[model samples]
Target: MSLHDPAQLMDERRRLEGLGLSVTRYGGAIGLIGLVLACLMGFIQENGMDRFFFVYLTNFIFFLSISLGALCFTGIQHVTRAGWSIVVRRLMELLAANVVLMAILFIPIIFGLHSLYHWTHAEAVAHDPILQHKAPYLNTAFFLFRAVIFFAVWIGLALFFLRKSTEQDESGDYKISIRLEKVSSWGLFLYAMTTTYASFDWLMSLDPHWYSTIYGVYFFAGSAVALFATLSALCIGLQKSGRLTRAITTEHYHDLGKFLFAFTIFWAYIAFSQYMLYWYANKPETTGWILRRQTAPMLWVSLSLIFCHFFLPFFGLLSRHIKRNKSLLFFWAIWMLVMHWVDIYWLVMPEYVHQYGEIGAAPFGLMDIFCLIGFGGLYAAGFAMWARGRSLIPMKDPRLAESLTFENA
Candidate 1:
């Protein structure tokens, strides 16, 4: 029953039988098929491919940023020499490992470049002084180069930390811990830099003329909240399945809930800060984006994000009792996960609605839900595929004892 008891550890491993890897495989296949069908539907429609690209990039950035945040969280844990998270660190590691899969998913975006990015077209660049001025940085070649670099840095970091962690599992060398701590400092810096620029390239550049200096931070906040939501779900799901119930406890779930609660506030803060700046400035270019959201159909989506994404969760998770209750935390976690989609949908879909004027549902286009399912299913598949056979906890981490015995003060 103790942390050091091998029998206790082995018993947790016994609970992880199959762990639903087949489900992921089938789900991923279905998601991939749905994505293909969605693309075909778009290509056949009037402005179909463009709409498809919009949905693709929206969901891509959503899931990609989630993995990036997970990777960043793992690196932060390593860099800080954290003790309580050792039990959940393997889950972070596996989620981060999905960055490799995300890099591959980006390939289709490259093919649909013109449809998504207006800057890719020379004539538009010629007419628009801003696009012309930003041509050097926003050009197709340079953009592709930066995307490759971002993925390379991200994937490299994911692989390095994963290998080291798994290596520690086999070797149990304390030096490996020290080594991870040493590298994570620089790794996190690299993560921040790459992610900031990547956000500009991928999401912010969708409207080349519109810009926000805090855009990257806003994206990071949303991503971090979504990732924390995912972590809560995974941890709770595993516990429900009778896995990691020993190494992980209600105390750990409480901490995860606290994180979910905290980052929900953080997302609202960044969102407001960004909006506050643009609203206060009242510049036509900047204000137009906000104006569009506040206008008609999108105004509703924006308002929903407030109550759904911010205020509701804020009050729902404010209590210590709620944070500690698995059912309540899981409910909020699932809620946020859906709201996270709504967040990104609000960010992307409104533009298309304004231009094309009512594509799918109110704010979201017709294909938007399919895109979400496609990406969610695929992301789950990636996380599950990597998680299979790996320890439900970091079984060999020396500090894992500390994690298993963690108690909140």
Candidate 2:
């Protein structure tokens, strides 16, 4: 803790002096191929751009959630001024920074807005009372305006913290930390508003007649948990590549595991709470959405989520011994990530399929995989490029010593 300990500080810096991260090499190729294939599949698909936009929306939210979750993670660290996460915070910063790229990626969704939301149809809005009632907020012009504002708020906050954090790594300015803390505190309220309304605009309005007050919070829960799994997997993979092998220790991974475990439960709680209240009230409008997921073949996916998303991880990650084990924890992290995808897929694909008087999983078909690969490849590549520009850890953070030497009791 002494300012006189120059040699000790230099040792820590040397450990993170080189981080081997190159996304453009292999990752760029994968992204290019996936997107091209997705485009080809889009053109080839039957009927309009409906199928293509539907696929895009599913994948768009999937990747966007992880980015926003990282934004939330960055905001939390800055606000709390937490010491334990300094070693791994840069990974999260890079993820949060991808919010810029996601906004650009969201352009296609903007062009295809009419394809995804029923309320955007003029004739349909004219005929349907519900759509008419919601028209003041759900009109295309206002929709695009909200989308732009949401991206601006998220991107601005994301860049500010990331920029300041990188600068502090160079200058070791203590004031930068204090400034980030203030920005992060104010930024949390902005994040909540943007994400909530954005979720309603993007996801909830898919079922035009359906409404749920907690849907945005539901989106937040899944997104945050997904980021935990992502960070855990990234750290393990980087360690395997001999990057940050010593810098990010098992203690950090254990905390990551704990978060993954905790939020898996939180996601389930929000999910069930939404369903339980809706089920009890028996409102035809809201209950229809849940029923579509609960009845027939769709119910199979719902049960699968209950087991995979909640129970499996719940019991599997319950032990402190399991949390501390690297390989076992990585396995569960992958499981939770897959389950999160399934969870979103269930939420989205059912409405798409119901248009044809059928409801189920992947019924809209395999373009889902293609778009996922496309966006996932692009998102990962952005993460790598961002990480390549800086130290793998926040090497000069005042709390770096605490994080590097962290222990879990």
Candidate 3:
């Protein structure tokens, strides 16, 4: 039963495998069905088929953000060799593994380029002098090429770190840890540049005419918030399953709560700063985008975000006691996740429906569910499989002992 004994860990792995098989079977089925329903609904709605392409593209990018953010978190922990996060790092690795699934999901985005992005229309691009000027860089051929490079780099780095960490667990090798640290240091820098540009290429290009220099940062901040929320929820769920009962304690939950609170504020700050600069400058192009969001249903959703995403969580999580309480933190984490989804919906839905006078829930349909389920089910299934035979903690980490005994000062 010694923590460091490889044999004891193997026994634990068998228990985990049994747990995973049952969870994956039930959870995967429900998730797949829900997603299929969303996709079907999308197909049924008027213009739903066309809009489905955009929705799918958006979901794919959102999933990519989660996967990449997980990769970033894992890299950061290695580079810093932070001890406090050892227990939760496995969750991040599992999430990062989903990057491969996201890459496959991106194919729809490529095929639907003409439907989703204005720049993809040759006739439209030819008439617009500005778009024409950017054509060399914005062309479909270049776009696909860039996407492949981005995913290849991301997948390679994620797998490299993950494999090294897992191998080190069995062999008790410190060199693997050191090697990963070196890789992660460089990986972090590359991630920053790639994610920013990827956001510009995928989301920002929806409105080719309107541009924001800070758009990438805006997306980056949101991604971080979403990732933290996701981690908190995942940890809480794992605890509920009776695993990690000893390893993930109130102290860990407390720190996770603090992270969630900090990122929630960061997301709001970045969002507000972006809006304020554009609004104050009064540039026609910049203000026009805000104007579209300010009217009708988008406006209400924007205001709801002010409360649900920030103000509610800000006040709710302010108490030290709240952060230390599992149930309370879980509730806040789930709430924040919902708000993040709404935030993304607000960001994307406007681009497609802005031409219409005001926004309305067009209809609930299949495409939405299909894309979400198709992607989400695969993500969950992969995460479960990844979790099956590994110590949830990095057992051989030089810092594992420190992490097991860690206390916040």
Which one wins on TM-score?
A: 1
The numbered model that scores best in lDDT is 1
Candidate 3 differs from the real structure by a C-alpha RMSD in angstroms, to one decimal, of 2.7
* Residue 167 local lDDT, model 1: 84
Encode model 3's per-residue lDDT on 1-409: one tens digit a residue. 1243323333333235677776677657866676566556656776655677767766777677777778888999988878888877877887887787778778767777887788888999879999998898888999899898888888888888778888877787888878988998998998888888888888888888888888888887777777887888888887677666566667778888888898888888998999999878999867978887787757777889888888999999999899988889889888887787677777777887853223466323456656666667767776777777766767677776666566777
Q: Which scores higher on TM-score, 1 or 2? A: 1
For TM-score, candidate 2 versus 3, the one ahead is: 2
lDDT of 1 at 258: 87
Order the numbered candidates by lDDT, best leading. 1, 2, 3
> How many residue pairs clash in each candidate at the backbone level?
3, 0, 15
lDDT string, candidate 2, 1-409, tens digits: 2223223544443222233244645566777687778767878867536777777888888889988999998999988989888878888888999998899898988887777887878998888887888889889999899999999999999889788999988988889889999999989999999999999989988888888899999999999988999999988887776566667777888899999999999999999999899889997777789878877788888999999999989999999889889899999988988888888888787877765464334464556677788888788778777666576666578877777777886
Deviating ranges (above 4 Å) for candidate 2 = 1-22, 356-364
Per-residue error for 401 in candidate 3, Å, reads 0.9
Deviation from native of the Cα of residue 169 in model 1, angstroms: 0.9
Candidates 1 and 2 compared by lDDT, better number: 1
lDDT by candidate, in order shown: 0.84, 0.82, 0.77
